[model samples]
Target: MPAKLTILTNGSIKVEGDFEVCDPQGGVFNVAGKPAVFLCRCGQSAKKPFCDGAHKTCGFTSEVKASA
Candidate 1:
């Protein structure tokens, strides 16, 4: 399946299908064969680049909208 990314309202980015996640240094973060992944957007997750459900407590907000 083709990779798809969905930005959740005021939350993390939901990614599905075949995809690769990499760090700033070009190191790949293994997903362990998982079919879906949620990425941090509020910059509050202790697990940077991954969602730790911190947005709920961090008061993160965004007015930007994404188009399909």
Candidate 2:
């Protein structure tokens, strides 16, 4: 299975592949081979770590490159 990488405009890193998401509370959210994962970068997400589309309002953009 190939990993899917996506670069969003005015948003954080949206990774869609075999990965895991962990919070500061020691909470782990396993993707189990998901198709999309939004990572926070604006440092103002109410969801923390995970992006909740707050970047649209904050105008936060990521300069990440997509790779297969």
Candidate 3:
């Protein structure tokens, strides 16, 4: 399946399907064979690129909408 990203309300961005996360330097994240991943959007995650559920306690809020 193609990569899909779902931004959660007041939380992390849900990532699914065939995908691999890479940093700006071309380093790849070890997400192989995983069903999904929650990426940090709040910028409060100690896990950096991954979500550790910090948004729940950090008072993060965002409502993103797609442009038509």
lDDT comparing candidate 3 with the true structure? 0.93
Question: CA lDDT of 15 in candidate 3?
Answer: 94
TM-score of 1: 0.86
Poorest 10 consecutive residues by lDDT, candidate 3 = 59-68
Instruction: Write candidate 1's Cα lDDT for 16-47 as tens digits.
Output: 99899998899999897898999999999999
Best-to-worst TM-score order: 3, 1, 2
lDDT, candidate 2, 1-68, per-residue tens: 45565667667777776666777887888766567888887887898768888888886666765579
Instruction: Mark the regions of model 2 whose C-alpha exceeds 4 Å error after superposition.
Output: 2-5, 24-27, 30-33, 61-68
Candidates' C-alpha lDDT = 0.92, 0.74, 0.93
Count: clashes, candidate 2: 0
Q: Residue by residue across 2-68, what tens digits does model 3's lDDT show?
A: 9999998889999999889999999999988899999999999999999999999999999887779
lDDT at 37, model 1: 95
**CA error at residue 16 for candidate 2, angstroms:** 0.9
